[model samples]
Target: MVLRTARVGLRLTRGQRNRCFGLLRAAGDVWACILEINSWRRRRGEPPVAGYQQLCRLLTESGPGTFAELDTAGARSVLRRYSDAWFCAAARRKAGHTDVRFPRRRRALMPIRWYHGTFALDGRRLRLPTAAGCPPLWVRLDRLAPYPCETIRSVTLLFDAGRLWIDITAELPVATYPAGQQPDPDRIAGVDLGIIHPYAVSTLDGAGLLVSGRAIRAEHRMHLADTKNRRKAVAGRAPKPGQRGSRRWRKTRRRARLVEARHRRRIRQAQHEAATSVIDWAVKQRVGTLSVGDPRGVLGLPAGRRHNLRLRQWQIGRSLAILHDKAALAGIRVHLVDERGTSSTCPNCRTRITKPAGRTMRCRTCLFAGHRDLAAAFTIATRTPGGVITTPAGMPAGVVTHRRAGRHLPGAGRSRRDPRRPAAPGSVGRLRPAPPPSVGSRSSIPPGMDEDPQHTTGKPGER
Candidate 1:
């Protein structure tokens, strides 16, 4: 069984919201107290209490009711979070990562987690465990939990993007298929990850699938433009460092957070759709193994600001992770191999060629031309670890399938345009045209400049 977590928003009354935040604040206080104790211990030249049991002992010494409305189990979860983080940092540092730092910073609010049986889940309403003598805290979820209640392992209450959310984690069993319809382990497909085409999958049986990401790219660009415009509009209202923000500034910040959250949700949904498409295609083809090209090594390079922004928006790691998780659930194995030179090398003759500027990749040696990303996938398929690279019969002729990732995104459908964009120059519902150039006046001149061209009845070739 694999563990998966889904976040659901909370619908709460004013009192419930306050109480939830109170619990989170109490958890944060617990975290801060631990950090302070560790700091004092370090100052005294003593080993810090980073273990979960030791921290629990310390918490017990502090006595009960120390954190209002926070039960012992809930507080211990915070200690567990800190201990896990501290040990993770130590491990990373020991592995030659000097930049890794222990958790010492304080937070005003921290997410509190409760394991199964500690919290009560009843359809849309959750009963969170509170301190003894405290009234039971029940909050409603905006939507029903995705997983069954019996499979739920834990729930974590946290605040994000100006709203409260609970992440429900559940253990799910791997999917099983009927006999004679199971995925063939020998049948493999290569996946090429790209910016424009997020997933390009090529199988040994001469089939390819391309999932376009143009809508996602457009969403990113539009969000950046909107954010820049909003920031410019509110630059004067922005509070100076160490100064409290005005009410208007706070409202603007809240609006910004909402927009950011929406953008993130849209992108995440589209990525999942893209990954699902790839998995479905693989299942139909009876392909069990997916050879994914890993491109994370180049992300650390100092690209220009524009290129860096593009790379960041690409979200390559998340895309890969989503695909990997979905593939695993589908009983398909995913192997990430080094993708260097995959796009440039010709799959047929193995000759290195310059990366194409567009989607088409043409080989100078073998005169073979195909989609660039698919070509990369084909090459990647051949390089799967511990797998033979034998070409299937009639390999050059593959059935190509085209699919789009963000069809639900604004402006993605045929009948809908992005509401965020202004109307086109000649589109309907736009304001009426200006007076039809005023009967041969200078207003009819084309857009290059304001100057009116010299009018004459000259024929062709006349200056």
Candidate 2:
């Protein structure tokens, strides 16, 4: 079995919202107290306490009601968060990363978590454990849980993008297929990751699949332009370095944050759709293994400011995670291979060629021409780990299946970004239907206009 998480929003009344925020602040206080203890230890030249058991003992000694409306389980989760962070930082520093620092910053709010047995789920309602002698805190979910209640392992309550959400994690079993329909381990496919096309899959049989991300790209571009305009419009109202922001400025910042969150949600949904398409195609073709190109190694290199922004918005790491997680659930093996020269190398002759600036790549040595991304996928299959020379004579893109992502995003219509492309079905801001022409010819005038039977300026039988 593997673990998965889905975030579901909460449906709360005004009082519930305040209570939830209070719990978060309590968690933050718990975190701050831990940090304060470590600070005193540092000042006295003594070792800081970070062990989970020791911290729990310390919390018990402080007595109950210390964190109002926060139970032992909830407060312990915060302690666990701190201890984990400290260990993670220590490990990093021990591994030659001296820049890594232990947890020291104070936060106004922190997420609270409840284990499987600590929380109760009833359809769309959730009962969260609170401090002793306090009424049980029950909250409603905006939507039903995606996973079976029995399989749910934990729930984390956190505020993000100006909204409250609960992350529900569950353990699920891998998919199983009928006999003869199960994917063959020998049948492998290669995946090429790119910004324009999020996923390009090529099999050894010359079949391919390309999931276009043009809509996602346009969404990012439009959002960027919109954000720039908004920022410029409010530049005069922005607070100085030492001055506190006015009420209007605070509202503007909140609006910006909401917009940013919405943009993130749209992009995330589109990426998931793209990944799902890849997995569905692989399953249809009985593909057992996928060799995905790892491009993160090159992300740290300076590629100019414009390209850097483009790369950052590309969100390559999230794409990889989405694909990997879905592939795991589908019982498909994935290998991440170094993708340094795959895009420029000739698939037919195995010779290095200059990377083309366009979608098509031409190899001078072999006179080969094909979709650049597909060629890279084919070459990536040849370099899959745990296998030697698995790729056959590389073929140009053929019998390819095409799909698109981000159809539900705002401004997905043809006019918002590209005039040539039609709007995606079910997209936001779809154009209105064309209206009847106002101007009419003499032979086809409206009935109310110049309607004379004997000397008619319009056609006869106007009805």
**Model 1 score (lDDT):** 0.83
Which regions in candidate 1 have their CA more than 4 angstroms from the true location? Answer: 239-243, 386-395, 415-463
Show the lowest summed lDDT stretch of 10 residues, model 2.
454-463
- Give the Å error, residue 16, model 2: 1.2
Q: How accurate is candidate 2 locally (lDDT)?
A: 0.83
Clash number for each model: 0, 0
TM-score between candidate 2 and the true structure:
0.88
Q: Judge candidate 1 at residue 104 and give its lDDT.
A: 95
User: lDDT per residue, candidate 2, 265-375, as tens digits?
Assistant: 989999999999899989989999999989998789999998999899989889999999999999998999877798999888888899998777788998887778888
Local distance difference test values of all predictions, in order: 0.83, 0.83
Candidate 1 residue lDDT tens string, 271-382: 9999998999899888999999999998999899999999999999899899999998899999988789988987778889999886677789987777778888878888
RMSD of 1: 10.0
